[model samples]
Target chain A: MSIVRRLGLTFGLPIILLAAWWFASANSTDFFFPPLSEILTALKDEWFGPRLLADVVPSVLRLLAGYAVAVVVAVTLGVVIGTSRTVRATLEPVLEFFRAIPPPVLVPIFLLLFGIGDGMKIIVIAFGCMWPILLNTVEGVRAVDSVLSDTARTYRITGTARLRTLVLPAASPQIYAGLRQGLSVAIILMVISELFAASNGLGFAVVQAQRSFAIAETWAGMLMLGLLGFLLAMLFKLVENRQLAWYHGLRRAQRSS
Target chain B: MLDVRGIKKVYEGKGRTVEAVRDLTFTVDQGEMVCIVGPSGSGKTTLLKIMSGLLDPTAGEVLIEGKKVDGPPPGMAVVFQEYGRSLFPWMTVRENVELPLKQKKLPNARRKELVDESLSAVGLAEAHTAYPWQLSGGMQQRVAIARAVAYEPQVLLMDEPFAAVDAQTRADLEDLIRDIWHRFQVTTLFVTHDIDEAVYLGQRVLILSSSPTVVRQDLAIDLPDERDQLNTRSSPRFAELRAQVYSQIHRPKADAAEPVGAGATAVDGGASGYGAAPDLP
Candidate 1:
């Protein structure tokens, strides 16, 4: 597809939805449902200034720290698990059990251990976000083609060189799939973690606006969070495109021929 | 300088025991190109795997220069049949070719030089930046050849490397292999189901019987040094050699290498009959 057409496909629905929301709430009188103009005004007043720095910076940093931890730990563990049948058999069921527990449920458990500090919130995000990436990495590593592995072996490309040139690149497509899933999980956990016994963050700000009945500001905070999530996803997609160019190109070549 | 000493492979899996290769033995001399031919289900791949140290034989061993190969030897390289899967799709043609050289720990200048020379040798000089998947099947196989060539191994092993490409491409690759074999003088073991390919590229063709497989005949190719796609293939000698190999594969499984070919006459319209085995059966 042409870039213009792809851009149209991506942005077309959101533009229409935003326009619909603008007119639908234009004459609203309910306190919960405010005018779009009021929400925009609230957005500017609430976050387009000093508060943006004080709250958003810390929230984003926490999200990043937790996400980095998740990615590193998951991929490392995933490779170990993927490479060995014994390890996979022993740990997979336990990992699946943990995965089934909703991440929000763990926020309380982490809070009990760490208390309501940055550590608790960070752990909450990290623990919540690790599953998808971990599982995907295992699947990817396990699925590395046998012919490629044989070629590597016969050529004596062993140890770290084998890992870097063969295993990692072969498993990256699926790892990226996991990373994408984990991103959304991290964002959600970031908000939910702040909602419990937290004084400042994107989630805290939203709750504060709600408790004090700053309805428009509360709506604005949510709008900002959604937009933030959208922006992060777009950034991730950019990186994925650059990284998996070969995979995509291969698929294209295969399909056309 | 490669030896298969009493190699046997039995695949025991899924409540069944299948003997893939049964007591096979052969040898390839230094700087010689030998092709192994057999019908389907003849355990050709299993034998190659055992020889290449990718898989262990149930009994026996492969030796390079009289040393037992317990693992993939540092002085050998393999070009697999599935060129699509064998070449790393994530790497460009140059990167794929240079990877094994890097493993060999050659310095940067020499590595680049070998990669460049090998790529050009296989007619892939202009495809350095292209990914393996972006190239045609033949081009991808050339990249694989370039990789094996760049490794500069004492021995090179290929398993049906041209099975996937079109006929035209296959002919080109066959010539390329013979050209590389002559120039570098790397002892090569080429395995293929195609009798014509085996006859064309090999100095000697090792004809294998059906599973449980064994060497049926070790026939030396008597074609001239100068060979081409058109003239060499149409030669009566080429037809005669291929006919012998073709017949050998179709015959009932033989438990031992046969002592034949001495009394056989050359094909029709040929004055110079081929000689008997230069080495013992």
Candidate 2:
């Protein structure tokens, strides 16, 4: 009963919101607040047309490239810093200071260095996303169960085999937590970085349409961004479900009566 | 097969020092089954860690087959007390058992044979693919045992492996371990606080004193080689040996207060020659 009802409640809110929007704007004639039907049509034409190849593809590729770079760098450095006290002490405060400064505030600095190109925007997204992953990985690596570590040592499981089988899997739950958080930040920065600088992207498309008073296209772009966020979240969930099945099973068992 | 010569461990940290083990010295002969019994916090664990080469001693050294140990000796495996934490939660039972074998660089065929045989020995054949967290505490301990058995180490160190389970399950696991030990003929060092368990399982029981611990007594168990949960425990000889071990662990310096054969807790059959006036014999 709980499972079925909760699932029902999940889809219930989204359906209700869509229904309200469709009805409230269906009869309106305002140029700014266009009808939901017209907005949906524009969303389809704008996204599913040639504009997709130019705008959506580039935006997604930048986001993915940035996220990939962040995942690798953060996980590698996190493990190093987490395992070594000297490195952690030397670098942690600086990382904290960097993380504290809002990512959007760094756009001007990135633009100054990398120019108004894909490289600058990509680096900004990577920088914004890297912190959660790095911090969580560090905490996770440090908190690996001492007994498990001792077990590996007693078995003479050293070097890469030790890291791959023992350290990485033990720290994965926390790492995934950080990855999910970083994904959200990545998405936000993907849009924010382009808002001030980019020639093409979902954020650019929306801003450009608004300035030209193509209000329907602006709404359509907003809708597309929302869809992209939803789809990315779903994609992450799929990967996490496959990768973290054991953790999920454990959690489910823990929660079961 | 294993030798511990004057091993002492002093943990120094943050301007504080703890002498966990003090001059603990003993030798476990090849194929010997010994149990070390101590009061809680008597540093039985610290001693075991030193023997297993997981910790360096403050003074002396552990020698495995005449090789001085600085790190985990290549020929040793340990089943820790915290089964929940010791078993890798991310790995399946088979994977956990195979991990050490992979470290040994055993051929794939030999690794599979050992894992299969060891799992069956501990009755976990169907649980090959199951994660450690999915199993019951008793079963998890069995997996740990299977893992140690699969490693085929020269010396197997078990630190209160059954302490986390129910009484009935603990009894069953005790029998399982004894069976594994006999079949494999690997030297074993089992640590526990339960006197009955120590007496029932070990060929020689090493009693340990309280904090800053030392070996108090080393009593040879003189029971028959064949043992069972019911007859071996209920036998008068088992009771006498149990009484002897209990006295050694609890009343080490107070031996003159009561006859050694006087059981710590009275047995069902009283006034036996073994328990009462043995001088009449």
Best by DockQ: 1
Off by over 4 Å in 1: A1-10, B253-281
Q: Write one digit per residue (lDDT tens) for candidate 1, span B1-281.
A: 67787899999999999999988777777898888998988999999899889899999877787778888988999999999999888999999999888888899999999999999999988999989988889999999999999999999999999999999999989999999999999999999999989988888888788888877777878899788989999999999888888776675434244423343333221112112113323
- Lowest lDDT 10-mer window, candidate 2 chain A? A248-257
Worst 10 residues of 1 chain A by lDDT: A46-55
Please give me the DockQ of candidate 1 compared with the native complex: 0.81
> Candidate 1 chain B: worst 10 consecutive residues by lDDT?
B268-277
Off by over 4 Å in 2: A1-7, A255-257, B252-281
Which lDDT values do the candidates have, in the order given? 0.89, 0.87
Which structure among the candidates has the greatest lDDT?
Answer: 1
lDDT of 2 by residue, A1-257 (tens): 69889988899899999999999999989988999999888888877776698889999999999999999999999999988999999998999999999999899999999999999999999999999999999999999899999999999998899889988888899999999999999999999988987889988888888999988888999888898999999999999999999888878766772
Clashes of 1: 0
Each prediction's TM-score versus the true structure: 0.94, 0.93
